[model samples]
Target: MTSTDTSDTSVLDDPVGESLRGRHAPLGRTLGRAAAYAQDVATFSAVPADPTAADWSDLARLLGPGAFADMFSCPALPPAGWEPVFVLEGRQMVWPDGGRPDPEPAATGPDVTELGKADVPEMLDLVALTRPGPFRPRTRELGTYLGVREGGRLVAMAGERLRPAGWTEISAVCVVPELRGRGHAGRLIGALVTRVLARGERPFLHVAEANTKAIALYERLGFASRKEVTFRGYTTP
Candidate 1:
């Protein structure tokens, strides 16, 4: 299952009605005239009163020359002629029912290791093998990441991403093909949820709407779908 997330409580039909237009948008990273990642951990999810020439220009400027971004927006994004690559309708799911910590599951495989910068090579290898999601070299700098290893090789892992005011997203969850059915992903998610709850925040995630298997697993783990989102990656011209 691929773990990830993008965007707000619910986007507004009127972008200027008080959400995206304000200096203090719900998203900490979004700034004046646009809300986007300065670090480019993920795409710039924005809400312009309308996708005007200037609005798109602001998005492009924030992204920089020829840089790409995966923009998550609501139903009506006017065609801005940005280069398109990957696009999908996704679900923003939140753990409204809270964490279900399994005491034994935390140590399911070999002891879970708190991964750090030194472990990025193995982490990137695992991510490449599993296709979890976009994990840049600096992505690890954001927050806590934990993994399970067997015989000195990373087998499974999970981590955090896209934090809004009161919610932290659990992302990059995957287990190597040879290590499936060992409950590794579940254990990692449980651990992440516990940490988020400890910090007085809720856990949330995003996944493709068609990813029924992962969605079912999350539903069983107390996550409820909050909104349908269109996650789009564009190569800025």
Candidate 2:
């Protein structure tokens, strides 16, 4: 298993290569090449440095003709044949001790509930309203998602994203604009963390570097920043 944080090599030297290679290997679209990613290109894209032209070819063939992203753990110059759709920078945080954190003495609001496949429509609508991240129809298959509903409307949610080997990513954590400070996000995160720990896995997540509010929240909740990663978007010629 690759460490959540690495300093043994330059990020450009390995980038997200190890984690992609080790944890999400089964979800990979290509083999025998340094680049790998989840089966869902719409969800995420990543490339290790120094991918051969053939590696790109295999990924392109899997992706077919369209626009998608290629998120590198470290920022580097774009490859020759691909068009740069956009570039993003963010921080990856992790809770290494299997998501265990000091228990909060406060009570979880009654509106909070565990969500399943039956909740996809409401989940997508909330995702559309909040734009937390790329949440597709099947993204929920990654793991459990918890939410807080108000008047039968899903208002806040937090759920798993990437599942490498021993860790599960807590992602798409969002709350409606009107419900910002009532601890809805915290409630959902706590619920998810509990679930991750119960299953013998740790929790991790990503957030834009500029999103200090969320960063502070995660920090307060005992998550530590692991690395600064660049999310690169790519498109075919």
Residue pair clashes in candidate 1 = 30-35
Best candidate, TM-score? 2
Which sections of candidate 2 miss by over 4 Å?
A: 1-42, 48-50, 72-78, 96-99, 103-107
Off by over 4 Å in 1: 1-32, 38-40, 43-52, 73-79, 97-107
TM-score of 1: 0.79
Query: What is candidate 2's lDDT per residue for 179-215, written digit by digit as tens?
Result: 8888888878887888777766677788998899999
Estimate the Cα RMSD of every predicted model relative to the unseen true structure.
5.9, 4.0
Can you write out model 1's per-residue Cα lDDT over 1-237, one digit (the tens) per residue?
A: 112222335422322223233422333254345556445344445645555666667666766767775565434453556778778887888876445554443345578779998998898899899997877766665568999888998999999866555556788998999887777887788888888877776778888888887798787677888777776777766
